[model samples]
Target chain A: MIIKNSIEGSFHLTGGDFTNAGIASSELKSILTELGLDDNVIRRAAIATFEAEMNVIIHAIAGTIYYSIMPEHIKIIVNDMGPGIEDIELAMQEGYSTAPDWVREMGWGAGMGLPNMKKNSDEFKIDSVVGEGTTVEIIINIKQGLR
Target chain B: MNIHEIASKLSLDVKTTKGDLEREVTGCYISDLLSDVMANGKEGDIWITHQTHPNIVAVAILKNLSGVIITNKRVPEEDTLKRAEAEHLTIMTGQAPTFEIAGMLYHFLRC
Candidate 1:
Protein backbone atom coordinates (compact mmCIF):
# COMPACT_ATOMS: atom_id res chain seq x y z
CA MET A 1 0.00 0.00 0.00
CA ILE A 2 1.27 3.44 -0.92
CA ILE A 3 0.35 6.67 0.78
CA LYS A 4 0.70 9.55 -1.65
CA ASN A 5 0.81 12.17 1.03
CA SER A 6 3.00 15.24 1.37
CA ILE A 7 4.70 13.88 4.49
CA GLU A 8 6.00 10.34 4.89
CA GLY A 9 8.67 8.49 6.87
CA SER A 10 9.75 4.95 7.74
CA PHE A 11 11.57 3.58 10.77
CA HIS A 12 13.40 0.25 10.91
CA LEU A 13 13.23 -1.72 14.14
CA THR A 14 15.49 -4.61 15.15
CA GLY A 15 13.96 -7.37 17.20
CA GLY A 16 15.06 -7.42 20.87
CA ASP A 17 16.50 -3.95 20.48
CA PHE A 18 14.77 -2.75 23.59
CA THR A 19 16.99 0.26 24.09
CA ASN A 20 15.85 1.96 20.87
CA ALA A 21 12.33 0.59 20.68
CA GLY A 22 10.36 3.76 21.28
CA ILE A 23 12.31 6.02 18.92
CA ALA A 24 9.95 5.58 16.01
CA SER A 25 6.92 6.60 18.02
CA SER A 26 8.80 9.59 19.39
CA GLU A 27 9.65 10.76 15.91
CA LEU A 28 6.08 10.29 14.80
CA LYS A 29 4.85 12.29 17.78
CA SER A 30 7.16 15.14 16.87
CA ILE A 31 5.99 15.08 13.27
CA LEU A 32 2.36 15.26 14.32
CA THR A 33 3.18 18.09 16.70
CA GLU A 34 4.95 19.93 13.92
CA LEU A 35 1.85 19.57 11.78
CA GLY A 36 -0.07 21.37 14.55
CA LEU A 37 -2.48 18.51 15.11
CA ASP A 38 -4.80 18.44 18.09
CA ASP A 39 -3.23 17.32 21.36
CA ASN A 40 -5.67 14.44 21.89
CA VAL A 41 -5.26 13.32 18.31
CA ILE A 42 -1.52 13.39 18.61
CA ARG A 43 -1.67 11.47 21.87
CA ARG A 44 -3.77 8.69 20.36
CA ALA A 45 -1.48 8.47 17.35
CA ALA A 46 1.56 8.29 19.57
CA ILE A 47 0.05 5.56 21.76
CA ALA A 48 -0.90 3.45 18.78
CA THR A 49 2.53 3.91 17.26
CA PHE A 50 4.29 3.11 20.50
CA GLU A 51 2.36 -0.12 21.05
CA ALA A 52 3.04 -1.22 17.48
CA GLU A 53 6.71 -0.38 17.89
CA MET A 54 6.92 -2.47 21.04
CA ASN A 55 5.21 -5.36 19.33
CA VAL A 56 7.92 -5.33 16.70
CA ILE A 57 10.72 -5.17 19.23
CA ILE A 58 9.35 -8.06 21.26
CA HIS A 59 8.06 -10.45 18.59
CA ALA A 60 9.68 -9.83 15.21
CA ILE A 61 13.18 -10.47 14.02
CA ALA A 62 13.00 -7.12 12.25
CA GLY A 63 10.37 -4.74 11.00
CA THR A 64 9.63 -1.36 9.47
CA ILE A 65 7.03 1.21 10.47
CA TYR A 66 5.73 3.63 7.88
CA TYR A 67 3.75 6.73 8.65
CA SER A 68 1.95 9.28 6.48
CA ILE A 69 0.39 12.56 7.45
CA MET A 70 -2.42 13.36 5.07
CA PRO A 71 -4.74 16.33 4.94
CA GLU A 72 -7.55 14.68 6.88
CA HIS A 73 -5.97 11.73 8.61
CA ILE A 74 -2.76 10.25 9.95
CA LYS A 75 -1.94 6.63 9.15
CA ILE A 76 0.72 4.23 10.43
CA ILE A 77 1.65 0.83 9.04
CA VAL A 78 3.81 -1.63 10.98
CA ASN A 79 5.12 -4.75 9.25
CA ASP A 80 7.24 -7.22 11.15
CA MET A 81 8.91 -10.50 10.24
CA GLY A 82 8.15 -12.74 13.18
CA PRO A 83 6.25 -15.71 14.42
CA GLY A 84 2.84 -14.66 13.25
CA ILE A 85 -0.12 -15.08 15.52
CA GLU A 86 -2.06 -18.27 15.05
CA ASP A 87 -5.22 -16.69 16.40
CA ILE A 88 -5.88 -13.04 15.63
CA GLU A 89 -9.06 -12.93 17.71
CA LEU A 90 -7.34 -14.26 20.78
CA ALA A 91 -4.47 -11.86 20.33
CA MET A 92 -6.78 -8.89 20.23
CA GLN A 93 -8.31 -9.79 23.55
CA GLU A 94 -7.00 -7.80 26.47
CA GLY A 95 -4.79 -9.65 29.03
CA TYR A 96 -3.77 -12.16 26.38
CA SER A 97 -0.02 -12.21 25.75
CA THR A 98 2.63 -14.67 24.68
CA ALA A 99 5.58 -12.52 25.70
CA PRO A 100 8.18 -14.30 27.75
CA ASP A 101 8.88 -13.67 31.38
CA TRP A 102 11.91 -11.54 30.58
CA VAL A 103 9.84 -9.25 28.41
CA ARG A 104 7.23 -9.01 31.13
CA GLU A 105 9.96 -8.13 33.62
CA MET A 106 10.63 -5.11 31.46
CA GLY A 107 7.13 -3.87 32.28
CA TRP A 108 5.68 -4.79 28.89
CA GLY A 109 4.03 -7.93 27.52
CA ALA A 110 0.98 -7.34 29.66
CA GLY A 111 -1.39 -8.36 26.86
CA MET A 112 -2.47 -4.75 26.45
CA GLY A 113 -0.47 -3.76 23.38
CA LEU A 114 -2.86 -4.74 20.61
CA PRO A 115 -6.02 -3.94 22.55
CA ASN A 116 -4.75 -0.53 23.54
CA MET A 117 -3.71 0.22 19.99
CA LYS A 118 -7.18 -0.58 18.78
CA LYS A 119 -8.76 1.50 21.50
CA ASN A 120 -6.68 4.59 20.76
CA SER A 121 -7.06 4.42 17.01
CA ASP A 122 -10.12 5.37 14.99
CA GLU A 123 -9.52 2.41 12.69
CA PHE A 124 -7.24 -0.59 13.21
CA LYS A 125 -6.50 -3.74 11.25
CA ILE A 126 -4.22 -6.72 11.77
CA ASP A 127 -3.01 -9.37 9.29
CA SER A 128 -0.66 -12.22 9.97
CA VAL A 129 0.32 -15.62 8.65
CA VAL A 130 1.72 -18.08 11.15
CA GLY A 131 5.54 -18.43 10.91
CA GLU A 132 5.68 -15.64 8.35
CA GLY A 133 4.90 -12.16 9.68
CA THR A 134 2.33 -9.70 11.00
CA THR A 135 1.18 -6.33 9.77
CA VAL A 136 -0.83 -3.74 11.70
CA GLU A 137 -2.40 -0.63 10.29
CA ILE A 138 -3.85 2.23 12.32
CA ILE A 139 -5.59 5.41 11.27
CA ILE A 140 -6.66 8.37 13.38
CA ASN A 141 -8.93 11.01 11.92
CA ILE A 142 -8.06 14.68 12.23
CA LYS A 143 -10.61 16.86 13.94
CA GLN A 144 -10.55 20.51 15.02
CA GLY A 145 -10.83 21.53 18.65
CA LEU A 146 -11.55 17.98 19.76
CA ARG A 147 -9.20 17.94 22.71
CA MET B 1 0.55 22.29 41.51
CA ASN B 2 3.79 21.85 39.59
CA ILE B 3 6.40 19.14 39.83
CA HIS B 4 8.60 21.11 42.19
CA GLU B 5 5.80 21.69 44.64
CA ILE B 6 4.58 18.10 44.47
CA ALA B 7 8.04 16.75 45.01
CA SER B 8 8.56 19.05 47.94
CA LYS B 9 5.25 18.14 49.48
CA LEU B 10 5.79 14.42 49.08
CA SER B 11 9.48 14.51 49.93
CA LEU B 12 10.46 12.81 46.71
CA ASP B 13 14.12 12.55 45.83
CA VAL B 14 14.81 14.37 42.60
CA LYS B 15 16.91 12.12 40.42
CA THR B 16 17.67 14.21 37.34
CA THR B 17 18.54 17.88 36.96
CA LYS B 18 17.57 18.26 33.33
CA GLY B 19 13.73 18.41 33.17
CA ASP B 20 11.41 21.26 33.97
CA LEU B 21 10.59 21.11 37.64
CA GLU B 22 8.02 23.82 37.16
CA ARG B 23 5.92 21.79 34.75
CA GLU B 24 2.39 21.76 36.11
CA VAL B 25 0.95 18.51 37.44
CA THR B 26 -2.71 18.38 36.47
CA GLY B 27 -3.35 14.75 37.55
CA CYS B 28 -1.68 11.49 38.49
CA TYR B 29 -1.78 7.91 37.17
CA ILE B 30 -0.10 4.95 38.85
CA SER B 31 0.68 1.79 36.93
CA ASP B 32 3.57 -0.44 35.97
CA LEU B 33 1.97 -1.60 32.76
CA LEU B 34 2.98 0.53 29.79
CA SER B 35 -0.25 -0.02 27.88
CA ASP B 36 -2.42 1.03 30.82
CA VAL B 37 -0.57 4.31 31.01
CA MET B 38 -0.79 4.73 27.26
CA ALA B 39 -4.53 4.16 27.17
CA ASN B 40 -5.54 6.04 30.32
CA GLY B 41 -2.85 8.53 31.25
CA LYS B 42 -3.49 12.17 30.38
CA GLU B 43 -1.04 14.84 29.38
CA GLY B 44 0.72 16.89 32.04
CA ASP B 45 -0.09 14.21 34.62
CA ILE B 46 2.38 12.62 37.02
CA TRP B 47 3.05 8.90 36.47
CA ILE B 48 3.86 6.62 39.40
CA THR B 49 5.35 3.28 38.55
CA HIS B 50 7.83 0.72 39.78
CA GLN B 51 9.13 0.00 36.32
CA THR B 52 12.39 1.81 35.72
CA HIS B 53 13.36 1.50 32.09
CA PRO B 54 13.98 3.66 29.05
CA ASN B 55 10.53 2.76 27.76
CA ILE B 56 8.99 4.62 30.70
CA VAL B 57 10.76 7.73 29.56
CA ALA B 58 9.42 7.19 26.08
CA VAL B 59 5.88 6.82 27.42
CA ALA B 60 6.25 9.95 29.54
CA ILE B 61 7.40 11.88 26.49
CA LEU B 62 4.84 10.32 24.13
CA LYS B 63 1.99 11.11 26.51
CA ASN B 64 3.50 14.52 27.26
CA LEU B 65 3.35 13.65 30.94
CA SER B 66 4.77 16.13 33.37
CA GLY B 67 6.97 13.74 35.37
CA VAL B 68 7.67 10.15 36.51
CA ILE B 69 7.77 9.13 40.15
CA ILE B 70 9.54 5.81 40.73
CA THR B 71 8.27 4.18 43.89
CA ASN B 72 9.79 1.91 46.55
CA LYS B 73 13.21 3.50 46.37
CA ARG B 74 13.91 1.87 43.04
CA VAL B 75 16.74 3.57 41.18
CA PRO B 76 16.45 4.10 37.47
CA GLU B 77 18.94 2.31 35.28
CA GLU B 78 21.82 4.27 33.74
CA ASP B 79 20.36 4.14 30.25
CA THR B 80 16.94 5.11 31.56
CA LEU B 81 18.44 8.16 33.23
CA LYS B 82 20.23 9.11 30.01
CA ARG B 83 17.03 8.93 28.00
CA ALA B 84 15.14 10.83 30.67
CA GLU B 85 17.77 13.53 30.59
CA ALA B 86 17.74 13.69 26.81
CA GLU B 87 13.99 14.02 26.77
CA HIS B 88 14.03 16.57 29.58
CA LEU B 89 11.66 14.34 31.52
CA THR B 90 11.34 14.89 35.21
CA ILE B 91 12.08 11.64 37.14
CA MET B 92 11.89 11.34 40.90
CA THR B 93 12.54 8.57 43.45
CA GLY B 94 10.43 7.92 46.49
CA GLN B 95 10.80 5.48 49.36
CA ALA B 96 7.08 4.99 49.59
CA PRO B 97 5.37 2.21 47.71
CA THR B 98 3.14 2.75 44.71
CA PHE B 99 -0.04 2.84 46.78
CA GLU B 100 1.30 5.31 49.29
CA ILE B 101 2.59 7.67 46.67
CA ALA B 102 -0.59 7.34 44.65
CA GLY B 103 -2.74 8.09 47.66
CA MET B 104 -0.68 11.08 48.72
CA LEU B 105 -0.64 12.48 45.19
CA TYR B 106 -4.38 11.88 44.86
CA HIS B 107 -5.19 13.79 48.01
CA PHE B 108 -2.74 16.55 47.21
CA LEU B 109 -3.96 17.07 43.69
CA ARG B 110 -7.61 16.68 44.57
CA CYS B 111 -7.55 18.89 47.62
Candidate 2:
Protein backbone atom coordinates (compact mmCIF):
# COMPACT_ATOMS: atom_id res chain seq x y z
CA MET A 1 0.00 0.00 0.00
CA ILE A 2 1.11 3.56 -0.74
CA ILE A 3 0.48 4.50 2.85
CA LYS A 4 3.53 2.42 3.76
CA ASN A 5 6.12 4.17 1.57
CA SER A 6 4.64 2.85 -1.67
CA ILE A 7 4.45 5.35 -4.50
CA GLU A 8 2.77 3.54 -7.37
CA GLY A 9 0.01 1.01 -8.05
CA SER A 10 -1.91 -0.45 -10.99
CA PHE A 11 -5.58 -1.39 -11.27
CA HIS A 12 -7.10 -3.53 -13.97
CA LEU A 13 -10.33 -2.75 -15.84
CA THR A 14 -12.50 -4.95 -18.01
CA GLY A 15 -14.32 -3.66 -21.04
CA GLY A 16 -18.09 -4.08 -21.48
CA ASP A 17 -18.31 -4.64 -17.77
CA PHE A 18 -20.88 -2.15 -16.62
CA THR A 19 -21.20 -3.98 -13.34
CA ASN A 20 -17.70 -2.96 -12.25
CA ALA A 21 -16.72 -0.07 -14.49
CA GLY A 22 -15.90 2.25 -11.62
CA ILE A 23 -13.88 -0.09 -9.45
CA ALA A 24 -10.50 0.88 -10.89
CA SER A 25 -10.93 4.64 -10.55
CA SER A 26 -12.33 4.30 -7.03
CA GLU A 27 -9.36 2.14 -6.17
CA LEU A 28 -7.12 4.89 -7.47
CA LYS A 29 -9.09 7.42 -5.44
CA SER A 30 -8.57 5.36 -2.27
CA ILE A 31 -4.84 5.20 -2.92
CA LEU A 32 -4.77 8.96 -3.39
CA THR A 33 -6.66 9.48 -0.16
CA GLU A 34 -4.33 7.10 1.66
CA LEU A 35 -1.35 9.06 0.35
CA GLY A 36 -2.85 12.19 1.90
CA LEU A 37 -2.79 14.31 -1.19
CA ASP A 38 -4.54 17.65 -1.21
CA ASP A 39 -8.32 17.44 -1.48
CA ASN A 40 -8.45 19.56 -4.60
CA VAL A 41 -5.80 17.47 -6.27
CA ILE A 42 -7.56 14.28 -5.26
CA ARG A 43 -10.79 15.56 -6.75
CA ARG A 44 -9.13 16.44 -10.02
CA ALA A 45 -7.39 13.09 -10.14
CA ALA A 46 -10.63 11.35 -9.36
CA ILE A 47 -12.42 13.03 -12.25
CA ALA A 48 -9.67 12.30 -14.73
CA THR A 49 -9.24 8.71 -13.57
CA PHE A 50 -12.97 8.09 -13.70
CA GLU A 51 -13.25 9.43 -17.24
CA ALA A 52 -10.27 7.36 -18.33
CA GLU A 53 -11.76 4.26 -16.80
CA MET A 54 -15.06 4.92 -18.54
CA ASN A 55 -13.40 5.36 -21.90
CA VAL A 56 -11.86 1.94 -21.50
CA ILE A 57 -15.03 0.34 -20.29
CA ILE A 58 -17.03 1.76 -23.16
CA HIS A 59 -14.52 1.22 -25.95
CA ALA A 60 -11.76 -1.21 -25.09
CA ILE A 61 -11.44 -4.92 -24.45
CA ALA A 62 -9.42 -4.42 -21.28
CA GLY A 63 -7.31 -1.80 -19.60
CA THR A 64 -5.02 -0.96 -16.68
CA ILE A 65 -4.47 2.29 -14.85
CA TYR A 66 -0.95 3.02 -13.63
CA TYR A 67 -0.85 5.44 -10.72
CA SER A 68 2.25 7.20 -9.47
CA ILE A 69 2.71 9.82 -6.80
CA MET A 70 5.60 12.21 -6.49
CA PRO A 71 6.22 15.05 -4.09
CA GLU A 72 4.88 17.51 -6.64
CA HIS A 73 2.10 15.82 -8.55
CA ILE A 74 0.14 12.65 -9.33
CA LYS A 75 0.50 10.86 -12.67
CA ILE A 76 -2.09 8.48 -14.10
CA ILE A 77 -1.67 6.47 -17.27
CA VAL A 78 -4.61 4.51 -18.66
CA ASN A 79 -3.65 1.97 -21.27
CA ASP A 80 -6.20 -0.18 -22.96
CA MET A 81 -6.41 -2.98 -25.51
CA GLY A 82 -9.11 -2.41 -28.11
CA PRO A 83 -10.01 -0.44 -31.22
CA GLY A 84 -8.40 2.93 -30.95
CA ILE A 85 -9.80 6.27 -31.92
CA GLU A 86 -9.83 6.94 -35.67
CA ASP A 87 -9.76 10.69 -35.26
CA ILE A 88 -8.11 12.19 -32.23
CA GLU A 89 -8.96 15.75 -33.24
CA LEU A 90 -12.63 14.93 -33.69
CA ALA A 91 -12.78 12.99 -30.46
CA MET A 92 -11.36 15.95 -28.60
CA GLN A 93 -14.30 18.03 -29.68
CA GLU A 94 -16.75 18.40 -26.79
CA GLY A 95 -19.89 17.05 -28.48
CA TYR A 96 -18.52 14.48 -30.87
CA SER A 97 -19.11 10.93 -29.68
CA THR A 98 -19.00 7.55 -31.39
CA ALA A 99 -20.84 5.69 -28.67
CA PRO A 100 -24.23 4.21 -29.41
CA ASP A 101 -27.64 5.28 -28.07
CA TRP A 102 -27.51 2.61 -25.38
CA VAL A 103 -24.40 4.13 -23.85
CA ARG A 104 -25.94 7.59 -24.10
CA GLU A 105 -28.95 6.40 -22.13
CA MET A 106 -26.54 5.35 -19.40
CA GLY A 107 -25.76 9.06 -18.93
CA TRP A 108 -22.35 8.86 -20.53
CA GLY A 109 -20.83 8.90 -24.05
CA ALA A 110 -21.52 12.61 -24.32
CA GLY A 111 -18.09 13.19 -25.83
CA MET A 112 -17.23 14.88 -22.55
CA GLY A 113 -15.02 12.06 -21.33
CA LEU A 114 -11.76 13.30 -22.86
CA PRO A 115 -12.70 16.93 -22.46
CA ASN A 116 -13.51 16.43 -18.81
CA MET A 117 -10.27 14.57 -18.34
CA LYS A 118 -8.36 17.49 -19.85
CA LYS A 119 -10.33 20.04 -17.86
CA ASN A 120 -9.48 18.40 -14.52
CA SER A 121 -5.88 17.70 -15.34
CA ASP A 122 -2.89 20.04 -15.14
CA GLU A 123 -1.35 18.12 -18.00
CA PHE A 124 -2.90 15.65 -20.47
CA LYS A 125 -1.73 13.54 -23.41
CA ILE A 126 -3.36 10.88 -25.54
CA ASP A 127 -2.02 8.34 -28.02
CA SER A 128 -3.76 5.65 -30.01
CA VAL A 129 -3.48 3.32 -32.97
CA VAL A 130 -6.68 2.86 -34.92
CA GLY A 131 -6.62 -0.93 -34.98
CA GLU A 132 -4.73 -1.31 -31.73
CA GLY A 133 -5.54 0.61 -28.55
CA THR A 134 -5.43 3.94 -26.69
CA THR A 135 -3.41 5.40 -23.86
CA VAL A 136 -4.22 8.49 -21.84
CA GLU A 137 -1.80 10.16 -19.46
CA ILE A 138 -2.94 12.74 -16.98
CA ILE A 139 -1.12 14.75 -14.33
CA ILE A 140 -2.61 16.71 -11.45
CA ASN A 141 -0.40 19.00 -9.39
CA ILE A 142 -0.80 19.17 -5.63
CA LYS A 143 -2.10 22.63 -4.82
CA GLN A 144 -1.27 22.90 -1.11
CA GLY A 145 1.78 20.66 -0.88
CA LEU A 146 5.18 20.74 -2.50
CA ARG A 147 8.48 19.04 -1.74
CA MET B 1 -33.14 20.08 3.60
CA ASN B 2 -33.13 16.39 4.43
CA ILE B 3 -34.09 13.82 1.82
CA HIS B 4 -37.04 12.52 3.88
CA GLU B 5 -38.66 15.92 4.01
CA ILE B 6 -38.38 16.46 0.29
CA ALA B 7 -39.57 12.95 -0.56
CA SER B 8 -42.57 13.26 1.68
CA LYS B 9 -43.40 16.74 0.44
CA LEU B 10 -43.24 15.68 -3.20
CA SER B 11 -44.93 12.32 -2.62
CA LEU B 12 -42.15 10.51 -4.36
CA ASP B 13 -42.07 6.77 -4.83
CA VAL B 14 -39.12 5.56 -2.77
CA LYS B 15 -37.58 2.53 -4.46
CA THR B 16 -34.81 1.43 -2.15
CA THR B 17 -34.66 -0.45 1.13
CA LYS B 18 -34.41 1.80 4.24
CA GLY B 19 -32.65 4.44 2.15
CA ASP B 20 -31.94 6.72 5.12
CA LEU B 21 -33.87 9.68 3.74
CA GLU B 22 -32.66 11.65 6.74
CA ARG B 23 -29.42 12.65 5.02
CA GLU B 24 -29.06 16.37 4.55
CA VAL B 25 -29.15 17.67 0.97
CA THR B 26 -27.04 20.75 0.54
CA GLY B 27 -28.12 21.48 -3.02
CA CYS B 28 -29.45 19.99 -6.24
CA TYR B 29 -27.78 19.22 -9.59
CA ILE B 30 -29.75 18.50 -12.75
CA SER B 31 -27.80 16.87 -15.52
CA ASP B 32 -28.04 13.81 -17.71
CA LEU B 33 -24.37 13.88 -18.52
CA LEU B 34 -22.24 11.89 -16.13
CA SER B 35 -19.10 13.88 -16.87
CA ASP B 36 -20.93 17.15 -16.41
CA VAL B 37 -22.12 16.04 -12.99
CA MET B 38 -18.72 14.72 -12.07
CA ALA B 39 -17.12 18.03 -12.98
CA ASN B 40 -19.64 20.37 -11.39
CA GLY B 41 -21.91 18.48 -8.99
CA LYS B 42 -21.09 19.18 -5.35
CA GLU B 43 -21.17 16.74 -2.49
CA GLY B 44 -24.54 16.22 -0.75
CA ASP B 45 -26.39 17.47 -3.82
CA ILE B 46 -29.38 15.48 -5.03
CA TRP B 47 -29.05 14.51 -8.69
CA ILE B 48 -32.04 14.72 -11.02
CA THR B 49 -31.79 13.07 -14.40
CA HIS B 50 -33.50 10.82 -16.91
CA GLN B 51 -30.79 8.20 -16.67
CA THR B 52 -31.92 4.95 -15.03
CA HIS B 53 -28.89 2.75 -15.64
CA PRO B 54 -26.94 1.23 -12.78
CA ASN B 55 -24.06 3.59 -13.48
CA ILE B 56 -26.16 6.39 -12.10
CA VAL B 57 -25.88 4.74 -8.73
CA ALA B 58 -22.12 4.56 -9.21
CA VAL B 59 -22.08 8.26 -9.96
CA ALA B 60 -24.20 8.98 -6.92
CA ILE B 61 -21.83 6.96 -4.80
CA LEU B 62 -18.77 8.67 -6.25
CA LYS B 63 -20.24 12.11 -5.65
CA ASN B 64 -21.76 11.23 -2.27
CA LEU B 65 -25.06 12.65 -3.38
CA SER B 66 -27.84 12.80 -0.81
CA GLY B 67 -30.17 10.98 -3.20
CA VAL B 68 -31.16 10.46 -6.85
CA ILE B 69 -34.49 11.39 -8.40
CA ILE B 70 -35.46 9.91 -11.75
CA THR B 71 -37.85 12.37 -13.27
CA ASN B 72 -40.81 11.68 -15.62
CA LYS B 73 -41.68 8.83 -13.33
CA ARG B 74 -38.94 6.76 -14.90
CA VAL B 75 -38.16 3.82 -12.73
CA PRO B 76 -34.53 2.83 -12.57
CA GLU B 77 -33.33 -0.50 -13.88
CA GLU B 78 -33.45 -3.47 -11.54
CA ASP B 79 -29.67 -3.37 -11.17
CA THR B 80 -29.84 0.31 -10.40
CA LEU B 81 -32.36 -0.21 -7.63
CA LYS B 82 -30.39 -3.16 -6.32
CA ARG B 83 -27.16 -1.19 -6.27
CA ALA B 84 -28.86 1.80 -4.68
CA GLU B 85 -30.31 -0.42 -2.00
CA ALA B 86 -27.00 -2.14 -1.40
CA GLU B 87 -25.21 1.19 -1.22
CA HIS B 88 -27.92 2.80 0.86
CA LEU B 89 -28.36 5.53 -1.75
CA THR B 90 -31.90 6.84 -1.91
CA ILE B 91 -33.57 6.40 -5.33
CA MET B 92 -36.90 8.05 -5.97
CA THR B 93 -39.25 8.81 -8.86
CA GLY B 94 -41.66 11.66 -9.54
CA GLN B 95 -44.25 12.63 -12.14
CA ALA B 96 -42.28 15.56 -13.45
CA PRO B 97 -39.72 16.38 -16.07
CA THR B 98 -36.14 17.32 -15.26
CA PHE B 99 -36.77 21.04 -15.44
CA GLU B 100 -39.92 20.89 -13.34
CA ILE B 101 -38.22 18.79 -10.71
CA ALA B 102 -35.36 21.24 -10.57
CA GLY B 103 -37.85 24.06 -10.26
CA MET B 104 -39.67 22.33 -7.44
CA LEU B 105 -36.46 21.72 -5.54
CA TYR B 106 -35.42 25.33 -5.95
CA HIS B 107 -38.71 26.42 -4.43
CA PHE B 108 -38.40 24.01 -1.53
CA LEU B 109 -34.78 24.78 -0.86
CA ARG B 110 -35.35 28.50 -0.97
CA CYS B 111 -38.13 28.33 1.58
| Tens digits of per-residue lDDT for model 2, A1-117 | 223343888989899998887777777777777767766777788879989999999999999999988766788999999899999999999989998898887878999999999
Worst 10 residues of 1 chain A by lDDT: A1-10
User: Candidate 1: where are CA atoms >4 Å away?
Assistant: A1-5, A143-147
Per residue, candidate 1 scores C-alpha lDDT tens digits across B9-111 of 8999999899999899999988888888888898889999989988899988888899999999899998999999999999999998888888888899997
Give the TM-score of each candidate. Answer: 0.94, 0.92
- Candidate 2 lDDT by residue in tens digits, B1-106: 8999998887788889758878999999999999889988998999998888888887787777899999997888998898888889999999977777788899
DockQ each candidate and list the results.
0.85, 0.72
Taken over the whole model, the C-alpha lDDT of each candidate is: 0.90, 0.86
RMSD of each: 2.8, 2.3
The residue-level lDDT of candidate 2 at B81 comes to 91
Note the residue pairs that clash in candidate 2.
Answer: none
Tell me the number of clashing residue pairs for each predicted model: 0, 0
